[model samples]
Target: MNGRPVRVVENLNHALHESMLADSRLYVLGEDIADPYGGAFKATRGLSQANPDRVITTPISENGIVGVAAGLAMAGDAAIVEIMFGDFAGLAFDQLLNFASKSVSMYGRPHPMRLVVRCPSGGSRGYGPTHSQTLLKHFIGIPGLSLFEMSPFHDNRAVLAHMLGLGEPCVFIEDKVLYTRRMAGDGQVDDLFDYGFLGAGDTAPAHVYTEAHGDVDCLIIAPGGMAERALAAMRDLLLRHEISCRLVVPSRLYPVETDALLDAARHAAHVCVVEESTAGGTWGAEVAHVLHERLWGRLRRPVRLVHSADSVIPTAVHLEREILVQADTIVEAVLADLRGEGSPV
Candidate 1:
């Protein structure tokens, strides 16, 4: 590791390089990912030149790219497909839903389909509607498909390697804004909060950040792109309103692991979920449902959900900000819940 803090994009590039070197069967396929261009976000930088035979640049076809990756996985070779923009993932939904996901069990015996679809997702860069959208909820609950989101707290190297090791189809959501941000280290976040990991064993762990240890007024559960926003809200709430909050960021988004979350929720007076996606049938809703089921009749109020507006993202910078979930949005939601002014669940 370097002495300086590693950027999220650099970490991902390192993971791809290291994983490819370790496993000869690993291949990376995407558009404009070849050397000299190194992809739109530069996450695939130096990959093509280093492994010319393994790293392939294909034509513009989201469906075809994913289809080819799925076919490669079925042939016993691990493949990683990069969807240029998260919005275009919809074009390849049929391939992912029917072919990639079902191949694990549809055959006579359980097959190991080592396929990873890396999507540069989420808004905040003012990429407009077609280019910006956090569509994680749409891919949730797919059988044999594991969902993960990139965060500053978790190492992308481990995430990529772990998914490949699982030998199943995985959707690795990379928040575009996170690419340029420096990763947190030494049990610290923005020099304002101390952080630590919860949950034991090999599974991906939830990262908990707090200004100080002990009981908090509220526990905020956020994933991926919402981590920074959640942390900002936590800081503002504590500094301005004296509302102590504990922020929990999980790397794995799907197949909800509630042990760590339940432990944290039990101690807080209130709980809130923050996400970039719009309301309705969201990952936050799923988490809230699970928490309610497990922590029945013990919470002060219903789990508050803080999310983006339920509308298409606008191209204007100010309009996009209004549509997306900002730090202030989270602070207000938490404050409302504390004041008993939150909407009914």
Candidate 2:
């Protein structure tokens, strides 16, 4: 009614516009976020048109922008800073990690860090090394910041609205590949993927796609872009290998939905995690560790993590295919484990 129904990009645009109108102090600040430019992915297309003064554009300096945003938040302004790429998040580390994340606790301040850093993350578009990085693992374990990744099935408008009210600093990641993908449907806020078990609770995990009814051979856990590939691989596993698995995807990266994850893993014979980030000190690694630690007795096989190669992303498409976890790689990994030919992580 308010605007046309949209895919991921437009949905995010809608959320940003609504949040600004709802709160007087909330403003958007980033490079080229103004109209016509509308950010690197056009998620902020009409935002500057509506609120010309509030949607502030700045020079190219991640550190300066983040530092300014932190200062504004301390002065009671709710600011959303959009970083063009996840790889450049390292440049803003001093402001985010040291000041924004620790300000509330250190200063014993009343108002929390009313800041949100929007990071466009993940890669499959041959962006090469620096432009294509997840960098999520680097931001985790910080005491005060929240981490969120938008999902196609889950309602982004609802999630962003809630996050804006949290009164804490947040790192919100937007996958580049998801920008053009249409929403699965006008789904209910609680329904992750038309499945019943995972609801819209704050701690609920997303049910990406599942066939784990009576006997589940494996439970495939993936995040962001990996969820789509994992679901595709699952179809092959069922038809060709006759292996059934459940796909559990999480929208929130930090403050993980531990209970929901554990429940899903307990019912499966094997648990496998897939991620776009490289192996070792990755989000997938953490997931596998937790599942192994908690459900070791319940699990029939050791937890496995299939991830991108631990090196800079490649420029060539073929090299990328070889490095990233494609449908074949996923199918191969799962089937190898099922056949007892591969070592589990």
Strongest candidate by TM-score: 1
lDDT of 2 at 53: 80
Estimated TM-score per prediction? 0.97, 0.92
Q: Candidate 2 — which residues are off by over 4 angstroms?
A: 1-5, 186-197, 201-203, 210-213, 342-345
In model 2, the clashing pairs are none
Best by lDDT: 1
- Model 2 lDDT per residue over 1-345, tens place: 654447788878888888888888888889999989899999888998999888989899999999999888888888999998878989999898889988867875556778989899887899998898888888878988888887776567777766667778888878788888765553322232244337656325667444335558888887766767877788788878778888877777787778888888877888888877777787777777788888887777778878777788888988977877798888988887887775544
Q: Which tens-of-lDDT digit does each residue in 4-109 have in candidate 1? A: 7899899889989999999999999999999999999998999988999999999999999999999999999999999999899999999999999999999988
| Global local distance difference test of model 1 | 0.89
* lDDT at 320, model 1: 96
For each of the candidates, the C-alpha root-mean-square deviation to the true structure, in angstroms, is 1.6, 3.1
Residue 37 displacement (Å), model 1: 0.3
